[model samples]
Target: MRPALYWIRRDLRLADNPALHAAARAGRPVIPVYIHAPAEAGDWAPGSASNWWLHHSLQALADALAARGLPLIVREGESLATIVELIAETGAEAVHWNRLYEPARIEHDTRVKQRLKAEGIDAHSHNAALLHEPWTIQTGTGGDYKAFTPFWRACRRQAEPAPPLSVPTDLAAPDGARDLAGAVVPPAGITAPLDALDLLPRVDWAEGLRRTWQPGEQGAQDRLGGFMETALADYREGREQPAVAGTSRLSPHLHHGEISPRQIWQAVQTQLARHGAEGDRLDSAEMFLSEIGWREFAQHVLYHHPEFPDAPLNPRFADFPWQEDPGDQLLGAWQRGETGIPLVDAGMRELYTTGWMHNRVRMVVGSFLVKNLRLPWQAGEAWFWETLVDADLASNSLGWQWVAGSGADAAPYFRVFNPIRQGERFDADGAYIAQWLPALAGLPAKHRQAPWQAPASVLGDAGVTLGVHYPHPLVDLKESRQAALAAFEQIKKGA
Candidate 1:
């Protein structure tokens, strides 16, 4: 049989990978390859933290494929040129890969597929990341759903997602493949060592990220197992509390395609059955699945609206008067966790330290950036694109646009979140704040969330000195909020 190249992209796992399964089942010797092509990713290429995770994830994938007796070929270049060159050298008849939804990727993949087919090589793509392709789900009028509720409802009405493909345990590789295990140029042109990707940081800034995450398929499974055992029951409320480990930290893994949503959905169902979970337990499981639905919804929006990463979906937002942060001092303070708003500061600090943050805290900080600070949502999005390990274009775009009231089903522009009240309600005990903002650790729970409001005695008792140990709020919450509202009023009138 002629050889086939299994092109690995986001789908980096052995199991539940449709492209890999198809390649193996073609009765041809399969050569697995990962092409490092960051330039193809356009403006939102993997960030520093994401690159770190990608390095580890690729290493893990390489090891797994090697153990299965298939050497994963690592190449670097324009994807089509590299793959076409590989085909010529290996005498391969086919190339297969799971699809990616980002606009640039879609354009590149389409060109490659057409070019490969013109050369009479079988070029195939499969759906592995999402439960269903974005175009497959639609409203009764054959239009994309603008709101999440109707979209998810439509998804639920469809047939359940196909069962995940089983892991390909035994596989045959092409001729001379074993000899090509570590070969940089074994008749297939140039290849780079995994280390040559420059994915790791030169300054060793990721110790906290290393301690907090394990970035591969096994790691994803391990995280899911732990979540089902301990946190799935309280996910509804526990996810809201930052101090508790009530949420599944599976986002980076999911973003990397080390694990599929199908695996997660099935795993949750099986776990529920094993424990005979009912009542609130079942509700929590459903809520967790709905979060997964939101991920699908984000992708759906991105696929239909390819301009999602930069532009507002709602046209009226085009005229919104966003504040200009001269010299970016406001943005700098927010990014560095010196905003003097305890919860927002703590959330930003947690992200800086661990490359991750709690979901509720993410919302609070997002609101503070766009609403309270009246800054451009694009600024916050860019910062997150640089810092977050799980910075998916679809989700990041949806989140920032949603927070700014410029996207589908967005929060109203006038509903600015009061960081103090948000802190009091969510981080009621202030444990989340104290953990990240250690200077406020000695303050009472009441004062920790809003030390500016605390009496001079309380501040003194906590050993805190305003503008010395901690800065005052950058903008007065009340005054800034009204200014944001006034700006919104101007845009509303223009509309």
Candidate 2:
């Protein structure tokens, strides 16, 4: 029997991989292939941080496949062309892949599948990334859901997602297949080695990323295990505290498909069963799952409204007056963590160093960008795309739009976050702030949050200068909030 080619994309792992599972179960030898075609993703290509994660994740995937006696063929080219060449070289009878919901990917995959089918090859695409496919859930009137609560409720009304698939124990290599492990040049359609993908930075700037994350299936499982044991108990309250490790840091892993939502769902369910679902445990489990639900909602929204990444769901935002930053001075400060707002700066610095940010701080910084700074949300979105390891298109777009108050079920435009208050509420002791903004470490807890408000004596005692040690506030918070509200009023009036 001819072997089947499993085209790996975002779904990188072996265990719980629907495409790999189906290909393995076909009773024929399987050939796994990864095609690196960043341009195919269009403007939303994986950024530096994501690329760093990808480099290591692919290495991990390759090693795992080698352990199973199969070589993960790495190639750099147009995805369809690479797949076709691999099929011709290996004489594969079918192509199987997991689905991706990004508009560009969905369109490209559809075309690839149709073209393959026309050539008489079996083309199979399976749901491996999402708990429920976007089309599977709809409102009472048979339309896509615009709000998260009802969408989640509708999802819960459906049968529970099936348990995750186990890693196939019977992965057989095709006849004449050579183990291309560490091969500088492999024959038969292998164009470049993993290094040739150039998914790492030219400069060695990812040291912090290396320290913060382990980018593979094993690492993902380890994170989940750690979250369950250490944080699940107090997730509800703890997730709110930026200084606490209360939430699962499985985002980058999930974005890279090192772990599947179903796997997380199963893990959470197992915890509930083991500890008995009651009180805090149940609430925490439910709250955590709702986050996963939000991820689903974001993807579904992207699927139904393909313009989500670039345009607002609410048309009124099209004419909303966004402040002009002539030289990106405002944006540059925010990006560099020199915004002079401790909470916002800490979040930006954390993202720069770790390729991840605490959720609460993310909202705070996002609000500061779109509201307090009155800059275009897309500017912030683009920065995040280039920086965050978990820079998922769906989530990134939804998040920015949500903060801008121009998305479906978005926060009201009037709700501008006060960075000082946010810091006091979430990072009261300034632990999160100090960790990222060490220059402000000497300040009192209250002063750390808003050094501009500190007395001259307090500033002197802390060895801090307003502009030299920590930059002065870029914009007055109260004045900016009023300005943002006035601008919002214009959009509200369709001016």
Candidate 3:
């Protein structure tokens, strides 16, 4: 049998990887290869922060493959051209890879498969990323679902996902193959070392990211273990409070394919068994699974609506008057975390420094961007696509559209998030605000959420000057919110 090429995409890990397992089971020497083709990602290529995570994740994957006595071949160029050349050089007769749902990627992969089959080379794709492929779940009317609640309910009623596959105990390399995991010998004309890909930034802006994350398969498992041990108990409350380690923080790992959702689902089930008698634990576990379901829903929506990343799913938003702040001046301030709103700024700074944000805080800052600032939701989506390590195409589009009230089951257009109220309610003691906005750390907890509301004497005692030490609120929440409502109402009337 001819050797099989295991083309690595986002599904980076060996464990629970159906494509990798299938390639190995073909009874031929397996050639594991990863092609870095950012241009193919189109307008949503990996940004600086995500690139940093990718660099480390790839290195970790290389080490793991080496441990199993197989080499990882890394290349950078046009994916199809590079892979075809790889097939020629390696004498591989078949190629296997995990499927990606992004529109550009789907088009590219379809073309590649068609070309490979024409050339008499077998090509195959497997579902390693999502538990259920997008088309598999549908509404009672036999059409795609527009809302998450029913979509997830249908998902639950389907057969439970099978147990995750264990990593192959023995990986067979092609005869005459030498162990060369990190070594790079690309098809000559277009080959660069992983370091040469220049995924890291020149400036040292990643110290916080480094401290806050460990980006590999083992690191993902470790983070999940920590979350289960301490944070899972109060997960419902802990996830809401940004200051606490209440959430799993497994998103970047999930995005990079360092771990599979099936693995996570199975692990959560095991953890659930540990709390067999408790109702709260069961409820919290179910809630966490629903978050995963939301991710699935995002993919399903994006799969059906390929243009989701750039446009609103709801037709009414096409005519909605999106605010234009000349030069994106307001958007820039929000991105820089200098908007003078503690909770919003805190979430933005957290994302800038750590490449992750609390889900609740994400909603707060998203609402501020789309509604309070009245900026186009696309602007915020673009910024997040660049800043977030877990910047998934499906989720980013779904989340921003949800906040902007332009997607299915989105927050009602009239519902504008008042950042002050959100902060006071969620970050009641101001721990989250103080941690991210250290300039206002000395302020009493009551004043931390709204420094401008505090009395002049109180501000002086805290050693904070409204505009000097900390800037004043960018826009009055009440006034901006009304403006957003009026604008949305116009769209409604026209619709």
Candidate 4:
């Protein structure tokens, strides 16, 4: 039998990989390939931090595949053309891959599948990313759902997600397989060395990323285990506190296909079974799983509305008067974590240094950007795309739009976050603020939340000078809130 080619994309793990399992079950020699074609992603290509994760994750995947007696072929160019070339070179009769939901990827994959099938090649795609593929769940009226509550409830009413597949023990490599133990030499220019893809930054800005994350399957499992052991008991309350390691830091792992939602679901189910269903454990477990539901909801929205990344779901936002930053002065300040709002600054700085931010702080920073600064949400969305290791187009777009009050099930336009109040409520001890904004460390916890409000004597005692040691609040909170409300009113009237 001819060899089968596994086109590796986001799904990078050996376990619970449906597409890989199908290829292995064919009883044919298997070849795994990763094609680097960022341009094919359109304007939403993987950002710098994402590329950094990809570089490490791919290296990890290559090592794992080598242990299983297969070599991972790394290539660059158009995905379809490269796949066709690999098929010809390997004489592979089948190409299998996991599915991706981004607009550009959907279009690209649809064309590739149709073209390949027309030419008598077996092209199979599977759902290794989402517990349930987007189209499988729908509203009673048979229309796509715009509200998360209904959407998630519908998901829960359906069958539980299937158990994840185990790693395959039997595998065979095709003839002329590249040696995984040493330097790769491309055969007739069909493949490139992983380094040739140049996914890493040229300037070495990723030291912080390296310190903060482990990028492959083993890392994903370790993170999951830690979360279950220590954090799952208090997740409902602890997740709201940014200073605590309360939530599972498995996003980058999930985004890179290092872990599957089904795997996570099953893990949580096992925990629930150990502790019966009527206590804090059950509540916390359900809360954590609901977050996974939100991730599913984001993908569902994007799959149904392909214009989601660039356009607003609520049409009124089209005429919304977004303030001009004029050379991005406000945007730049926010991006660099100099916004003078303690919680927002802390969140932004944490994101820049760690390539991730706490969920609670993410909401505060996002609200400060679109509501207080009055800047366009897309600016914030684009910045996050470049800096976040787990930047998924669907989730990123949904988050920004939700903050800007322009997405489905969005926060009300009038509900502007007061960063001071948010900080005091969530980080009442100032630990989170002190960790990220060390300049304000000496101030009282209350004063740390708002230094400008502190007395001059307090500022002096702390060795802080507004606009010198720490920036003044970029915009007066009360004034910005009123201005944002007025702008929102204008759009409401027009709508």
Give the TM-scores of the predictions, in the order they appear. 0.96, 0.97, 0.96, 0.96
Pairs of residues clashing in candidate 3: none
Per-residue lDDT tens digits of candidate 1, residues 170-241?
A: 577776542223444332322235887789999999989989999989999999999989999888898888
Model 3 C-alpha lDDT per residue in residues 283-370, reported as the tens digit of each score: 7888888989999999999999999989888888888887878887898999999999999999999999999999899999999998
lDDT for 355 (candidate 1)? 88
| Rank list by TM-score | 2, 4, 1, 3
Query: Which whole-number lDDT from 0 to 100 does residue 238 have in model 2?
Result: 97
- The local lDDT score (0 to 100) that residue 208 gets in candidate 1 is 90
RMSD for all candidates, in order, please: 2.4, 2.3, 2.8, 2.5
Clashes of each: 0, 0, 0, 0
Per-candidate local distance difference test: 0.87, 0.90, 0.87, 0.89
Model 3, TM vs. native: 0.96
Candidate 4's residue-wise lDDT over 146-241, tens digit each?
999999999999999999999877877787644322344333223225677788999998888999899999999999999988999899999999
Model 4 poorest ten-residue lDDT run: 183-192
How far off is residue 149 in model 3, in Å?
0.7
Tell me the spans in candidate 2 whose CA falls farther than 4 Å from its real position. 177-192
Q: Which stretches of candidate 4 lie over 4 Å from their true place?
A: 178-192
